[model samples]
Target: MSKRNRASVSLPKGVHRVISRGREYFYYQIGRGTDHEGDRIKLPNDPRSPEFWQAVRQAQGLIGQVPADTIGALIDAYETAWPGLPRKLTEGTREQYRRSLKVVRTAWGDLQASSLKPSHVQALIEKLGANTPGSANNVLDALRAMCRWACGPRELLDRDPTQGVVHFDRGEGHRPWTPEQLSYADEHLTGMLRRAYVLARYTGQRASDIIRLGWTDVDDGGFGLRQKKTGVRPWCPIFPELDTEMSKWERRPGPFLLQDNGRPFTTNQLWKVFNAAREETPLDGAVWHGLRANAAIRLRQANHSIAAICDMLGMSPPIVER
Candidate 1:
């Protein structure tokens, strides 16, 4: 109770003692420049006990030994190297990898690539699958590809962490847009959004390819472009509906679908615009990609052969069959 007895006692530089409700509590700062920066560990036991010192020592050891070969580093290297390889990744595939890598980095960016075990990969997949199994599987695929790249060219690791890991079963698949939903969009969405929807339904191309369609791509009676995702060049005929939609807009030198400011839509911009229109309709569980499936189904309903469908959609026979 005297001033001399209450005088501060020395502890570790990063450790501090405080009194709350007349009880002393000890906490240790894990330090800066690490993933655990600003993190503090409270020692429940008495500071005079051996256990408290043991915990302190362990926390101190992790302070300045951050690993160099982190998951973030490996992903950065992979992104840089992937485009330069002889067999380069496609633009769409690269975008997919980038998105999945973002999710993985949020969870374990600073974690050492060499320290990852199959159990760690499995745990991540399980945690992600609880919310969205399809997304979990996509992340697993991205990790597997990154690990393979690291082993093959980067030589960052000798073994794959994703080797024994399995993906969650995403039951079923994307549903095709129904006629009623299409009608709803036609009535609700106007101008550029409507044209985009019409173009997707007619062409059966991915959103990436659709966004790149320009007036120059149009020819005598159809438009042709090499599909970005599959590398297949498809020349699809200009159906009556698509032609009618095109005639309503003045031809510009740029993309077929332009923003009000006369610029083509970036992938994100296109999705935002399309989703905004979609939200105004009475459809549920419908998506832009489903329009591609609708095109394939429409071709099938018209008694087209699998080969014809594949040619029209710029897809493989197996994908058409599916």
Candidate 2:
């Protein structure tokens, strides 16, 4: 976080400070009024800010050069660690990051991560978003995720360059279920609907993974399986909620959850049935995918850290942070 400089601020050589309307601003006036020199240039407001120093340096053509170790090195390190990282980077996401990092690498591979600022990020977003808003948002997500991961768990960077930056406002993707909506749905839930609801809520897994789970996968400890998206094998301990809900259900052979015909439900088939059941209730717009986000919210309400939730859900940092 950049804190504003209050008093006793220092100025670089040839830079003048002015106080107007009780606010401090900086300017360069060394060669002003000269035939060869252009008009005086106004500099950034905060002397302590990176923008302030960058402005001063650039004005004098004294731009500090990046050292041998650069943003490319950090991106390489992130790429190397991608496979074994605890957070889930799906196949598509891995490719997306690869492409996005390539773009960043091509743009500033020789530059230091510290050289990036919110202004640079915003400019990139504006440029890329001119054609495809989603593409711009995806690039920002890649940058934010990589920077956050570097700054947080990996300790690769002192600070996240993407901090204080905002991504494009992609509309609310998945709407999580409210407690009232979930509770009401529980009352109306039965058969596969009841089974799906219990599994999704308790396991904190997506519908694709949930529909795939069979009775053979469950154990005394919990449900154990490698998640479809992340390929992470997590022990999803059966919650008391699931236990209470399933106590009412008769345990059957084959898959733990099945259609009325007792066959396994495909992901699409499961969602169509689930959505139909949800329509009976007053709640609207809540989808099967929202259960994952709702599970995150529930765990967060219980004081779980974002990292813990991401790990538990096998989600990427970008998705979980959002």
Candidate 3:
């Protein structure tokens, strides 16, 4: 907070100390150019710590004109506005926002929110498309939600650059794993993979619910889970096989069926294992999520009504059709 501490602090090239109206931070060219100022910005936050500043300075030593304190204020404002939003988005929705913000940070970390344009939003959508169609849509949806929250009530985006983006046409819901694939998964998947996959295949529950399933949820032969994705609380008759599987593992393993390095498996980590199993499984197109699809398909095949499968999966009628 003193001039000595500030002076001893070396900044990236083009970055300088900026102190305005009792606030302090730093700034730099978010966009590259000569004679053009305010093209870039930054602030003192987790990402822009002293170590990062040193890296930037080493890369392009002592840049002129950009003020560091100003950048810090911008950083503060951007981060500050995020949590201030009023909406109580579901946990799944919050995760979506977090993922979207990561894209924004990676793309425009140096720019102030005022500097964001339709093109920046468009480019973020494009980068997201490189992954999956669903992921791209998620990034767009999350960004639009955040912008709306920041700009004010009523869909504040005039252009909504991501609005017109077309996602890939997925199949009429995912195809369930074939019999051979199921057999292979049963045989090949070991430890927690076996437990997780079996629960998914049997209950048709989302990964969110499946990971959080506990003894308390299991009553008599049916289990109760409030599906986080859909906010649906449904009681599903536990598959007899599921009971056998549960008996095999230690209970109260503290919430999650799978543990990695003694920590409960996160959805992200589950996907990683799922991807690996997909590669190994002869069922070429089936995903880890396809286990749920498999259960749905099996229920339908065994003469369960549409409503029954929907209830089991905690999906709405329309979602079940999709």
lDDT for every model?
0.76, 0.72, 0.64
Off by over 4 Å in 1: 1-66, 152-154
* Lowest lDDT block of 10, candidate 2: 1-10
Give the count of colliding residue pairs in each prediction: 0, 0, 19
Give the candidate number with the greatest lDDT: 1
Q: Sort by TM-score, best first: what order?
A: 1, 3, 2
Cα RMSDs of all predictions?
15.3, 19.3, 9.8
The deviation in Å at residue 292 for candidate 1 is: 0.8
Give lDDT for model 2: 0.72
RMSD of 3: 9.8
**Which 10 consecutive positions of candidate 3 have the poorest summed lDDT?**
68-77
lDDT of 1 by residue, 1-322 (tens): 2222323233667777767886677788856456767678786334433345556655677565444477765665566455345576777677788999999888888787788888988998999899999989989998998888678644788899999888886554678888899889878878878878888999888888888998899877888888877677887788898899888878768788888897888778988877665664566668778888888888888899998788778987866777
**How does candidate 1 fare on TM-score?**
0.73
